[model samples]
Target: MKFALQAKDILRNYANILYLLIGITTGCVIGFLFGNQVESIKFIGDIFLNLLFTAIIPLVFFTIASSIANLQSSERLGKLFAIVAAVFLTTVIISAAVMMLVMLAFPIAQDDTLRNMAAQAALDNPVSSNSNTSATGLAQVLTVNDFSELMARKNMLALILFSLLVGFATLRAGEKGKAFATFLNSANEVMKQLLAIIMKIAPLGLGAYFAYQVGVFGPQLIGVYAHPLALYYITCAAYFFIFFSLYAYFSAGKQGVTVFWKNNLTPSMTAIGTCSSIATIPANLLGAEKMMVPAYIRNIVIPLGAPIHKDGSSMSSIIKLAVLFAMFGKDFSAPEMLFAIFGITVLVSIVAGGIPNGGYIGEVFAITAFGFPMEQALPVAMVIGTLVDPIATLLNANGDLIASMMVTRIAEGKHWLNSRLPS
Candidate 1:
């Protein structure tokens, strides 16, 4: 009976991953067979994307506000924040280091053919034609204006700030604060339920989206830009499996690694299928529960990390920077440029979260950091982002779960996998 139960549990854990794989495979096969005709199915993908976007603002606001309001004490909140921030920063530093070493080992040469094609494509594409618009400075990116703007999807940083303030205020409002916190918590629960319902159609939604993507981009573009895309995917996979697994082992021993992979498999698959970390939050929280992370820690870290801790974006940004540098015949090895890339990539990753098709933000930063002609660079960057977004999303979503484990380990002085240890 115990063995049968164990097998059932394993199937439950891995079922989503299996479904996603089947959906992706089916989508690709249909896409190749039908080509651009699959464009008709894009509305199905749009519905899924819209469903995710609809849930994001409320989910983020309530989840963050309630988590902060429910913290045991101000001291505990501060400690949790510090631990999560440290882990995120450390990961970004490691990512930057890995990127530098990888680029050095396999330098990409200038491809004038591809460059010209990109330029021509940019000329023909209206969106790319205006890519030379004024650069968005870091100051502008950080600044928040009115409440309306703050609530907008483009201003996730501002929304997070607002949520934190409200949460803190609720914590101090005596009984009234408690009441408000309860409301937020209830609201967050509702959003999670809505997400679960929406996800029932995930295979269909994701399959249609993937089919449309393949049909539109086709195999030709994949062949044309295969090298950098392959490298980016491999690097992300390495980080997700190798570095993350090692980190888990060290943090929680063998049991930690086992729980980490088992719990995270579905979330990682959701990330790839949806190509949005925000959309994967519900699954990530479920994974956190499965891994035995405390509810308070999981609630706070996953929501915050979804937007703030973006290891996947950092790595992809580095890849884009390196490939663009090579294409432009610029030396990326210069000390000043390398430092600038590292700093900017880290900053951009934070702001880039919660925005759909946000990989282009890296290109904007690249334009500012490298003094590159935007018109010449934006097209190639867009192309790179399109191909690498799914893998990058996988990393971003997986990192959130990993951060939850690390935070639990640090704050509770106990490994999440070790139920014998008190949390």
Candidate 2:
């Protein structure tokens, strides 16, 4: 009876995660049997992504605007922002450090076959035009020229800035803005409910996408550059298990670790299946709620974190830089190269965090900044980026949940879990 009771409790709590696992497993089997034919079912996944993406634009706006609008004072919000920045920087550095060790332990070796294939592929299919990314390209990314453009997903950073401005204006309005503030809160709650409804089909959606991916991309996973792939995947796995747990424990001791794992797996799986940190924001927000992080911290942390606070990008950037360095026979550990690699890792994570495939911009930046021949280096970097993307995104997406906890602990004190949320 005791064993059965415990089993029931576990099932009740982890039902969603279990269903996601089953869905993915089923998708994998179907994919393997059908091979590339499974791509036909990709529309099933596309529907889910479209629904989620459409919902996200409004979700982000309302969540940020509402959370900030509700803050009692600008000082409180400022403190949270300061803490969020500190936590993000600290975690990114730690991720880079850990991967630096991993690279030293198992460095990438030059593969003539891989290099030759990369050269041929580059010739046949020119890489994206990011190799010449200019100042105008960056302006288009950061802030759209028109107000209507802000609604688009590609302009997330701009939307966030606008949301923050709206929030500040509402707060500054005092008594006159009470109705607007209330509406913001109500709309945010509605969006939250809408997200919950969308998530019901996640398993099915994720399954179909995984089927398509496995069918199409599985063969490409194992090749001459497999060493770099293994190194990246293994390092991500270890970092998540070890460092994530440590972050949780420090947030609120053993209880933090327990709750985090309970809230974590679902979001992590969603991230992996979707291969997008943006899509994972809804899950991450829910996880933060379960962990009892205040709205101010989570609103700023999770949404902002999705784009900028990517430890995964930090690790992978180092790996990509090293791989290119090895291919070119450059000393990766040279003092100046090490310094440049570290700076570039942080820059890429921040500059490229919000946009889809923004890493291409960073790769271009790296290639040009380091004086690597864009024609030769860009293709290698793009291939490695594509390969490592799934796991790297997993780290980047779920990382926000842990970061929210850290921010709460720092800004609200260690007893933040039990303390009254700041008004």
Candidate 3:
């Protein structure tokens, strides 16, 4: 019996290792072959993107609103929002700074095919062209007359603002909004059911999305784009160790971080296997409890933090947007990059504390936040969405543990900086 159990464990470990190899090799192949054939690869990616988000947004809306309602005081709600915004803003600025520094070390060349496509479109719609439009320019034209309006109208900033409004209002209504809130609350439950049905077919979507991406990108782009990919990987590894470990040690205590990491192996593994933070919440909650986090913090913070407190996701967002800007042969001024980071973090952080399985939709929202061309933004999503999910989830899970510690200290009115170690 013991031997059989050992063999099963070994097999499972090997299977996971094999899956990583397959996914990397597959993604490389597709990205290389289809690097220039943007439309076809994008179509497949779009299908998966749509299917992933069809039910995710509404579910997040209600769950977040419901979670806000659970707070004992409006003051606590204000505090929570403040903490979220601060953490998100800090991480975004760091990511954007890192991305800017990295770009200086690895200059990009514009893809001729993408440029040709833009030129042809400009000619076809000459009425759309203005004095600002140029035949040789690689960057997409952004007209001052409508750029900010388009960004707002598309709902990147609006979705976040509206969600916060709904959450705050839901808290304010003495009783009149109770029925309407009740309907949204119930709707949130039903949406989870729909998500469950869709998730069962997630493997199908994953396989097609990846296979189609690999078939298009071909195998050679990895070698062709090795420099940037290498830099991205280095950034990922550096954060995983340096920033996260330091934060964990200081915030959660060294012993707490070690215990949390050791016991929460299952959640990390599940995140990697599924590539969805929402799907891994059960393991995350269990792991936090095992690490001795208070029940209230575990139940409330872990679920809410999964979507919102994505240190790695925010990091990857800055990197992707920076890369897209560079790929079009445009340089973002430091101020522009700073604004992108600040704005993207706010937009992305709105649904952060929502229900599970909403990561993909958040990715879509991030792409829209910056108003990058869909072709460029979508491919980056394919790369980040497929590879970054697990790493981001681990960071997110860690952030929850870390944030809970800070929140608990705040709630207890304890000064964390000068407090003595617990006896």
The prediction achieving the highest TM-score against the true structure is 3
Ranking by TM-score: 3, 1, 2
Off by over 4 Å in 3: 1-100, 107-109, 113-156, 159-167, 189-229, 248-304, 327-334, 349-358, 403-423
The C-alpha lDDT values of all candidates are 0.71, 0.75, 0.54
**Residue pairs that clash (backbone atoms under 3 angstroms), model 2:** none
Q: Please give the lDDT score at residue 160 for candidate 3.
A: 45
Per-prediction RMSD in angstroms?
A: 8.7, 10.0, 7.3
Ranking of models by lDDT: 2, 1, 3
Residues 1-423, candidate 3, lDDT per residue (tens digit)? 997976675457345334534655654455555664443544544465455545545655666566565445534656665654565456545654565566556655456533443354345334422322232222232222333432332343344445556767877885776776777778777877776666544444444454544454444334334555566667766766676566556555676457555775787666655555666688877876666555765677668776666766665565565555555445644555666665765555444435444344455566555554443345445454445545655555656555555555445434342343355
Q: Could you tell me how far off, in angstroms, the CA of residue 229 lies in candidate 3 after the best superposition?
A: 4.5
Q: Candidate 1: where are CA atoms >4 Å away?
A: 1-76, 114-224, 414-423
Give each model's clash number.
0, 0, 18
Report the C-alpha lDDT of model 1 over 224-304, residue by residue, as the tens digit.
467777777777778778989976776588888888887777898777766678878999999989888899989998998
Model 2 segments beyond 4 Å from truth? 1-77, 111-223, 418-423
List TM-score per model, in order.
0.60, 0.59, 0.63
Model 2 backbone overlap count = 0
lDDT of 2 by residue, 364-407 (tens): 55665554545446545655676687788889998899999998
